[model samples]
Target: MYQMLVDLTKPKTIRGHVDVVERSDAGTVTSKGKKKKRSRKKNGRTSSGVGSDEKLNQGVDESVDGCTIGKLFVSNRVIAMGSNGTIVFEGTYDGCRVAVKRLVKAVAFEVNLNLRISDNHPNIVRLYGTESDQNFWYLALERCTCSLNDLIQRPTVSEDQAKEVKVPKVMLWTDKGYPSTILVELMRDVVSGLVHLHGLGMFNQDLKPQNVLIFKEGPLRAKLSDLGISKRLVEDKSSLGDHATGKFSIPIPIQIVYCFNPIAQYLISLAVTGCGSSGWQAPLLNELQMRAVDMFSLGCVLFYCMTGGGHPLGDRLECDNNIVKQSKVDLFVVEHIPEAVDLLSCLFNTVAELRPKASEVLNHPLFWDSDTRLWFLHDVSDRLKLEERKANSDILKALESVSSLAFGTKWNRKMGRAFLKHIGKYRQYNYDSVHDLVRVVRNQLNHYSELPLEIQKILGPGNEGFDGYFRSRYPKLLMEVYKVMHQFCREEERLNKYFKGSVV
Candidate 1:
């Protein structure tokens, strides 16, 4: 329901001709034809930045296309600006649509460059190349639909406005938008990207919804885009042995240090910008380790997505930084799932040390179900080949999606309660009897479509509507159920053949 005012058909307002400068092959900023000294600022703002002198015009070729120079044809269409005064322009390079991020100050160029180089994941923005002017640095990246914050914060369309359009659930907002399934997928994408980043030796000091971009393609995919305020971890000498292949280990050990690298220190001191908004920023930001800070921000994001775009720390978070530190996340939704509440509890824990690591979170049962466990595989092991790792992760994700669709969490809970009713009656059965019972249940489920009317009548009543709804979706549901039961049969067969009465 969030509407962004992006008119691709409408002519964009082009700013007038501006001088284009190039960067040296060594990556040094140069102005026109001379070596220019880059001015450093605590906040990323330079006096002579790009588009500083000109107003919006219809015709003005900046002529930013050269070798070590710019190669993008920047259009007048303006994307959202960053909190730090960075302007993103919709541009093109070699006929490929791209987003060009223009920064006033080149102070964080090296920092941004390092972070971009280290980042290479599907759920993170892809940086193609970079260009610079006398007072600005432009980063060419893959263009996305909009930032997560923009999408969530957009004004919901009035009922009158949407009277003609048939908006799908994926496109819905207000009281009927962004269900748990979509939220889980978004969370997984973001977490997967963060895990990849954390695997590298860097931490995103600025992890907020504004920094998370949304690609509105087949299904909504979210990507972590900005890393200007990120900090790279300086490896400790003692941890060398843990780096088996000399590659940085994931969930890397980091400690709270008083002094950060020059770039990160500069980012931390900014009053109005850098890092993240107060509510999303972790308490004792500088005192806790980098991962802890990121986890806190992730927690905030999770809270936002789960509650239909509400902030965890409340709207008053902007009034004082102390409020974020003291505020508790109270998930008050009456029908909220306990698993989601448990996840939030871990994220909002006051003690930073007690927070769960990114890897631990991906393996959370909330992300897996019986249907998911059959079709896909979870990658709990990091000791596999690159291709193998990716394969397993993709498979797991596919399985997870199948689970979300076929036996979504809501139905799973309902069915679980219904099954629990027979537990008391079956409690007296032995292991062998229990096995037979499971087989009989599987057989009945397999032929659910063919059950007699009288037999169906005795099956119970609390979920008659639910049962009918699922039966309507019978083919798809039954296919998934059969696939799951097939896996169970295979496992049982293997166990019976090898370990049937034998002690391991």
Candidate 2:
């Protein structure tokens, strides 16, 4: 694509600067000028509401005209505006949207997005090109509507029904968003976006739910943007060591009822978020495991959107995934609760691979199981109604039965110890001795769910599956193992209470 970094501070044109002119086979360029325009309009400034057509009309004829940077002209509309300090216009370039950003900053560290994009992924925005002059830096980027955090804060969908009449209710960000289709679509898109980034050998150190957006839901397209803090995964000298990096917050509402007496506050802190607006950031995220961190955020997002409620684990107190595992998401988002449940099931897996990858979600099977969706839509509200009146003591009766049946295996093993042993034995293969084995599992686990038929027979099996003899008979055992570790968290809580009282 054609791109240029024209100096906006020019008081004179290219015709006046013979010595500073940069001539190429394509065209002539010059950096010789007073470098400050009399009016902001001349420098590519305009009100936020101003359309691209109006903004383009005020400048030099030699500036970006139509789709062409220097010669081409075509139809592409500017879909978004950048920060207030930058005069930017974005449009479809060769069928893909591209942002043409140019502006002056007093003392901002210059960024070159393209150099790092090859190693970046779909969830992380790509930077294609940049141009610079004495007074300004020009950047051409991929464009999307806005941040995912921006979308969450705007408005959510709620239902209202009155005696034979049903109507759509548009609600501002208060814990939930539109029903099933939107949430599933958002999840699907975000997963695909994440898969793309991981493909480039990069890790999204800041993979919060709000950083994801469903730009095109019907087709299930998501774009991961905002790379100011994104870093490249490579064998290079440049590494991100908190280079002014901050995080975005999910606009889902807060459940302040959680914060009551001091004892309650301690308990509430475990279940609720300390971040503003009960941000969907996972509390354990601060531990820096860097393994399955994004999955934690995705699970939290699913919890909020499906419930139209506040943060999960409201009455609990903990920072680890154990609290997340024990604290269930309470809303029964009727239409797609099953699908939501399934997504959350895979997302919160203690073992990252067993959890669904963002790519696998492109066409989730839950979409095919029409019965589950219908069941949720019909029963969820009734259950909630019963809950509101405190009449739903039996609301989760069937679920409780299922859990009892599921947990019966507890007699066979301790949750965390079994998995720890499983990992120990699994590593015994391909090792000369126990001492040489790397604590890390070989990367093959990434392809666990998507193994080709040729490799499946050897790696995966049934009636307990090959994992029983290899990893573990029931893969879900890992969650149980983590649960065992989570049990110890109460000891920490007890210690915390004692410390809080004793501290002088």
Candidate 3:
């Protein structure tokens, strides 16, 4: 994607800067010099519109040859049509896939360029350049496979109608949920983008699921696009008061309204009236309070992720009625992952001032291990290296299997509580305690065949078939347990070895 943007921005020739002319009201066509002739292509229509081909045309103030409004990019197909009558075409520029947005309003070009031209972040969509013809303004943007909203609804939706339809089944808890790691990474991307935007004193007033694009070509990269409703915060009275500076009046469609909470609806009304989505808008939206607005929107996003596309406030009709009668949002009760529910509580604090900043949210225990160390900071490389070292070692493999099977006893309803109580002593430990726990666990595994009756029930009545299956899989699980314990012990050793008092 970056390579495509570079290609779009590259200077094609050494010609002097050309004066950009609005062809419809054109008067003068200047040349670089008397020696080089300047002429417009007659009767030739470029992909955008019928116009004279000025090969060395200027984009903004800079001269970029081989990039004419009509000939620079070739349109393949119309990928999507925005609710505001805008159209997006899948186009190719210099062999790179690009999404060319045919904006209905000319202001869109300025809106996009203002927020994204100098800003470059993986989590934020990249804008290549802008152009205009007689009817529409064309923007060259990075092509994304689909929107986050679409990806979330894909499992239950049919491909034929998937592009244009909504599926409620996506919100069902019984469905196969997205991996926890992916959800965490997606949230990280949103926070990272918000960190950059807020640092520059700007806020995306309308941050919603549809505005978040998903790039599936490589990683499941979530980028915040569509900055038409974003605004810059300055030191002034206008910043403090809500005077509708950066409100998007695009009416929220019935099928796509995710945020129907009363507070969100009220704020949306204050900014813009007449049928529009307010799902991502801050509860008490003060344009001056930039970071808080973004944090509130992020909280809504996190809630959606955690609940598998369930709206934080409620369904559309419920939110509409709740707005008139209800004072508080009925938060979803997450049974499987209470940690995520706790984080969401902080994010959705009624007092916007009390909400945690994006950086603070990133550091929350929701992203950390049982020991409070962040999962992303773990030395995965070391783990990979350790696994490679013991790949061919039979003794290590056997030990790993034994440990895993021993832990498997917890899956049984009858023995699970006993297993929990037994492991409680080893859950938190000092260097000496860790060593002792490892020794105890290792010794306990030595008598694996004569396991307690409670655990043996889960492994199935002792039989040749059951024994064979358990023997085949237990070593791998045991190895995983050993590696985790060993890593924790080694980390403590390193801390004590290098910094004498650090171990405490």
Candidate 4:
């Protein structure tokens, strides 16, 4: 959807003439005239800070065709541009299409980080090789179709326009925007990438829609790109560790190296003065620990995707102000998807410590199918039946809070007296307590098929019948129940059991 406005004719030359170098096995670049030894300290400092244990290789092996600098080519067509004037151009390497990023008068910090972790997962953009001339540094990376920003911000096509555009089948688009299933899958891809990065002791400090790239080669895949402002957590173990554990009283100062480009200068300013881009930044950006910052930004990104480019905390100009004041989010857009609303509430919670981890997010009920969600609801009802006596427990307290807030109240009335009377013969139904609410839902789901034809039509049919009805009528009931149940279950085991074949 991103407009490629640059002229296709007269492809601009990157460099008229230059000596091509090949990286030999000795950690040095050899040209036709001379051999230059690449500085290990410089490359290491570019990513991991001065004297850090994470060492970066000068270049990848020349044996791989993709890594050979001589086989790379750059065109004039621009793919995208950074805030600091870094230009990404459509290019090729070893006869394979790639994206060539040109940085003027600046070091390639992003490239250093990408080379270190690119091969670890499919959700991360790959780095083919790096090349430099007198004026600019070039990084060849995996080419993606477009960014998440472009995809979500695409204007809704009219009926006639829709007929003309040959959209991919995997992208399920409708007048109301993408379906919940497709949005969940895209968010899962992103969260998986975040989990991988967090496991490696890294934080993508700037995580907005623009940085999330979408690959449409097979199934639609979302990959995390643009690590220009990302931070390595192991750099200052004591400072960052203390911050992570809530020991630091003030925001830690970010270290900045001098760079000539305006883009790098702008990035340095953000690093030294703030967390990330304004609208997508976390509320407690200065105080929250490493991954929490990313999770909050991810919450904003998720909201953007689900709402067809609407921000939860108002528009771009007002978002930062709203976040600073802890203003109530405008969640009406996703009120129809209770599970999504619940997950977003946690991710957007004002208390940074309460936000779910990346791995836990993937395990949320939002990613579960209709059948899995129904099963989960049934399981929660069974557990609540046993634990109802432990009123002081956290799970019960959560349920009580949800009940007091009027979530799923008088459920039998909503089902009509006839439907209630039919199930009333089996057992007594009281909708006053949270336990009763769960029981009512569980009983209704259990006797779905046996219900009268009129009631069956009201509840719909097949697997999603009850779920669709309940989610539309009482948007918070099932999700609140899920939160209560999630607290009681072991996350690792639950994930292995329920999400075995699912999208997490």
Q: TM-score, each model?
A: 0.56, 0.39, 0.56, 0.67
> For model 3, what is the C-alpha lDDT against the true structure?
0.49
Query: Which residue ranges in model 2 land beyond 4 Å of their true spot?
Result: 1-111, 114-128, 133-136, 146-179, 208-210, 214-220, 234-280, 283-287, 308-310, 313-336, 349-356, 359-504
Report the Cα RMSD per candidate.
15.4, 19.6, 14.0, 13.2
Model 4 lDDT, full chain set: 0.61
Question: For each candidate, what is the lDDT?
Answer: 0.49, 0.37, 0.49, 0.61
Worst 10 residues of 4 by lDDT: 49-58
Model 1 CA deviation exceeding 4 Å by range: 1-69, 153-155, 159-178, 236-274, 317-325, 373-504
lDDT of 2 by residue, 1-504 (tens): 122222222111112211111101112222322122222122333323123433222222223334333111121233334443655553322222345555564422323432244324544454544545566555545544444444444343332211111111223221223344444555555666656655554445445545454343224334665433334444422122233222222223433543233333333443332221133433332222332555556566556554543345553334333343444444354322334455566666555435554455444433322233222222332333343465544433332333322233332242244344444554442222111111112222434455555445544453123323322322222232222223322135322221121101
Top of the candidates by lDDT: 4
Model 1 lDDT tens row, 342-384: 5667866787767776766665434443334222211111111
Once superposed on the true structure, which residue ranges of model 3 sit more than 4 Å away at CA? 1-71, 74-76, 117-119, 159-179, 235-276, 285-288, 320-326, 369-504
**Candidate order, lDDT descending:** 4, 3, 1, 2
lDDT string for model 3 (178-229, tens) is 2345656676677777767766666776777888876653446678877765
Using TM-score as the measure, the top candidate is: 4
Put down candidate 4 lDDT per residue, 397-477, tens digits, no spaces: 777777744364566656666666776788876666676767766877888867789888877787676776665556567
